[model samples]
Target chain A: MDNLFYAMIFIIFLTGFWIMLRQSNLIKKIIGMNIMESAIFLFLVAMGYVKEGSAPIATEANPGLAYVNPLPSALVLTGIVVSVSVTAFALGLTVRLYKHYGTMDVDEITRMRSEEL
Target chain B: MITAHIMPLTILLPLVGAYLILLVGSKHRSFARNFGLLTTGITFAMVCYITYLVSNQGKMAYYLGGWAPPLGIELRADPITAFLLLTFAGVSFFVLLFAYDILPGEINGKVITRYYALYLVLLGSLLGIVLSNDFFNIYVFLEISSIAAAALVAVNGDKLAMEASIKYLVMSTLGSGTVLMGIAGLYMVTGYLSLDFLAGALPQAYASHPLTVLMTLGMLTVGIAVKAALFPLHVWLPDAHGSAPTSSSAILSGLVVKVYIAVLLKLLYRVFPLDFLAALPLQGSLLVMATLGIFIGSIMAIRQRDIKKMLAYSTVAQIGYVFLGIGLFSEKAMLGAVYHVFSHAVMKSMLFLSAGLLIKYSGKRTIADLSGLGRVYPIPMIAFSVGALSMVGVPPLAGFMSKWYLGLGALEANQLLFLLVLLLSSLLNGFYYMPIVIGGFFKKETVEIRQEKIPLGAQISLLVLIAATFFFGLFSNIPISFLTPTVQGIFSAFGGGI
Candidate 1:
């Protein structure tokens, strides 16, 4: 089960990375980057999993206390929050880019900026 | 008198200052400037005092609210954190002063206050990263810094700024994610999240559980390399630093990149042992990447038309200096690496600011239009010359001091080949930097700049930095000794002697 989970994460991360590499559209590239980020988060959270463990928070004494480490969950929470913030900010920027250049393609933006230069 | 508030005060002062500026900041330029400058000025003083304490007292760790490590987040005041914090405060303070004229006109009304607010928060976050003792705390601070920095990059709200900010945001998030995964791996293996605990646990864990150790190290190293902009991982730096405002460029290139290097050093020396590192399959890959970055980044820099973008690419090469030092893994190399952290801040800040000033005062953004600029603006021209020469590793300058030490470190390691690479890159530096300086000064005045007026703050900062470059170059030993406590502390932490 653990191997299956790690394999899934690796596969998903690779797929996202693949999209980032192959995609021509700038927005799609950004989405692919975010996907890659999520995949890594998945791998991380998966690393902290136990076969039959429960949530880390404790209300009862020794309530089947085989729990996954709480630290990674805390870290992933921070990571997800930050990832969302950056995504929003990047999307804001993308909207502005579309307004200015009228294209969502990386190649076009490069050409336009180069020509301006 | 104050005991040891350097640990928390370094972070808290900036946070409070940022808030005060945000709250009280109106359209009043004088008001905003006063608050921002006062906050940063005090922080600079605090950093100097912190430096003295680090030199005198060795490593000092402070728990948050007096909570001890393993349970509470820790702030360690070893030489590395102190040195990095000093540069961050110093560079950001001067750059804040430099931005006095840029921010008001760059954005209007409340946005200027927002800019100052975000800038100070970024400063605070960087301080937190360098000083924090918990891996989770470091990740939180890294994210905060990255977001604030990206927002500031796009603050002026333009297409270039937007695109650059987005690219930086995406890549930086990826870096943070990778680092988070690494931290989780460590936590799962050792059941500890604090740096102090990890430092103790890592040795035994690495020996017993090789695969887990390898995976954790790989993730952490990749995450850090991504942040430090090491060669292939550096696709975002050029766009973000190049497209930001001049003051932001000064801060981003001059201070931010070095902080990543500092963090990477902390991770490598404090968290991972050299024995374990040597056991890795990709031991020399980092140095090889540094070499590639130096050659490729320099050549790429030479191909640029926009001056700031060129300087941004130059950073990719300069960062190679840090990695090269780390790769050699000698005290002399580490010393060179640490010293370059400061010198790079001073010299690169001056260079970027000069480029920005040239862009601002003269409206000449391209090299072709920079003809006869020196004749018109002699002071900035001379300053740029000193900076360019220093970067070219000319004598009696900070850049040369760093390169010299790095070369000595290489030779000390009996690595003559690395020494050759250093010399070759200095020559590459000449190829890239000299052309712009020579072209600016010696070329005929075809399209003369309309105005040559520069602000008093900008001019003073440039002169001070230029003099500082030469000062550190000539008096290398004193500055080096001050950093000795730091180098010794980190070296000792690794169970190795300096």
Candidate 2:
């Protein structure tokens, strides 16, 4: 059961990787990057999982109760911020590229650029 | 004592300076250049102080917020760190000095403020990468530097630069994601984010979950290799470096790519046990990839028509030398690798700055158009010749010293083939670099040449870099001796110390 969860995460990660490598549209490529980052975020969050653990808040009444690790959750916050910034930056570049080339297709852009050269 | 705070201040001063520039320079444009220069200059002083302290006192570690590791972040500096910090701080100051006159011309006037802001942020984050002793801290700084660097490349706001910046961003993001996943895997097995704690826990973790440990190592290696532009992963580098402004090219090719290698060295030595590294096929694979990168990158460089693009490809080949040194695993080879970091940083930045000047004065970007440039612009052409000779491993130049050490290292490891690779690559380097020097000086003018007065600031910057190239080569013993103990300390576990 534990292994199955990991296998699913691996599959999702590969799916994102494939999208990044195979996508022709610039927007789709950014989406692929996001998916890939999301998978890693999930993997990190899942690593801190304690089965049946409650939220990692201390309560006097439940002082001895199991609580999930809070560190990976904190790290995932930073990771998400980084991912968003990269996405924002990539989109900005794509907008500039589209304005110049008048297309969102990577292959088309390459052809146009080469033609200009 | 006061020294304890200096490390964090080295990083924060630049970060604060970056924002300060954005605030003030937005209103008053001229302030950006002077203030940026001041910030980098002061930061360089602090790094020098830190180097002095480390050399006398040995490795130093400071805990953030007075909390020890496994709970709080740690920043550590050893001999290797100090050496690299000096290289980064020194080279960046000179590059900024060179940029003072040239940048306003290359980039749009309005974006100049933003360019300085991004440049400082990139420097700050690069320092953070070298100083931070935790996995997550390095990752965060890595992303920051990556973003700042990408922005610098696109600061020209041209069609080609925009496209190049996007490609660099996408590929580097993939690298970052892989690195983060590797960190997560390490955390899963060891429950530690601190490198020291991770190192202590890793052997035990490996004992219980061998496959996970191996996978984590593989992930980290791949991620760092991509960022460092090792071998097959360097597809995005030429476009980005070629399209960036001159100073941007110098910083990106010279310092930024090398910082990732610093992180990799720290990880391989500090976080992983040496014997375990030896037991794997890691060194063999690194050696193979580096050899391929050396030959292929040089071959590609020879085919480039654009001078900047050719230099970018040359950077790819130079990086292979550093990796080759690391893969040799002998103490001297590691020293050569580390020294190459400094030598290449100085020589490459000099080449780019001089190239930028030649292109600016001649109004040409192709190698063929550089003919008769030496007579028209003697300073930049002379600087370029020095850089070229250094790159070709001419005796008593910076590049020769590093290659000599690397060759000696290869022989020490009984890998004579790489020594041959070292020699052949030098010949390959000569093949590409010699033509420019020859053509610039000896060939008759193909087109009318106009002489324009070179800026005093650019002249001073180029002269300083030229001097530094000669300095590092002649006084090579100083840094090599300084780095020896640390390299030995790292290889102590392998047990055959020099």
Cα lDDT tens digits, model 2, B215-278, are 9999999999999999999999999999999999999999999999998887887888888998
For model 1, the stretches where C-alpha displacement exceeds 4 angstroms are A26-34, A40-68, A111-117, B26-29, B106-110, B485-498
Candidate 1 residues A1-117, lDDT tens each?
777887787788777777766886867877777787787778667777776888888777757789886656666777788777777777777888888889888778889998996
lDDT of 2 by residue, A67-110 (tens): 89889999999999999999999999898898888999989999
Candidate 1 per-residue lDDT over residues B1-498, each given as its tens digit? 355676788788889988887777765657778788888888889988887887787767788888787877888876666777888898888888877776565565557877888889889998898888888898888888888888888888877888888778767766776787688778867878887688789878877887877888888889888888999999999999999988888888888778778778878777777656656655488889988988888888989888888899999998988898888877788888888888999888888888877776567688677768888887777878898999999998988888888898888777898899999888988987887789878998767576746777777778888888898899988878776655666555663211
Per-prediction tally of clashes: 0, 0
lDDT value for model 2 = 0.92
Candidate maximizing DockQ: 2
Which 10 successive residues of model 1 chain A have the least lDDT summed?
A69-78
TM-score of 1: 0.93
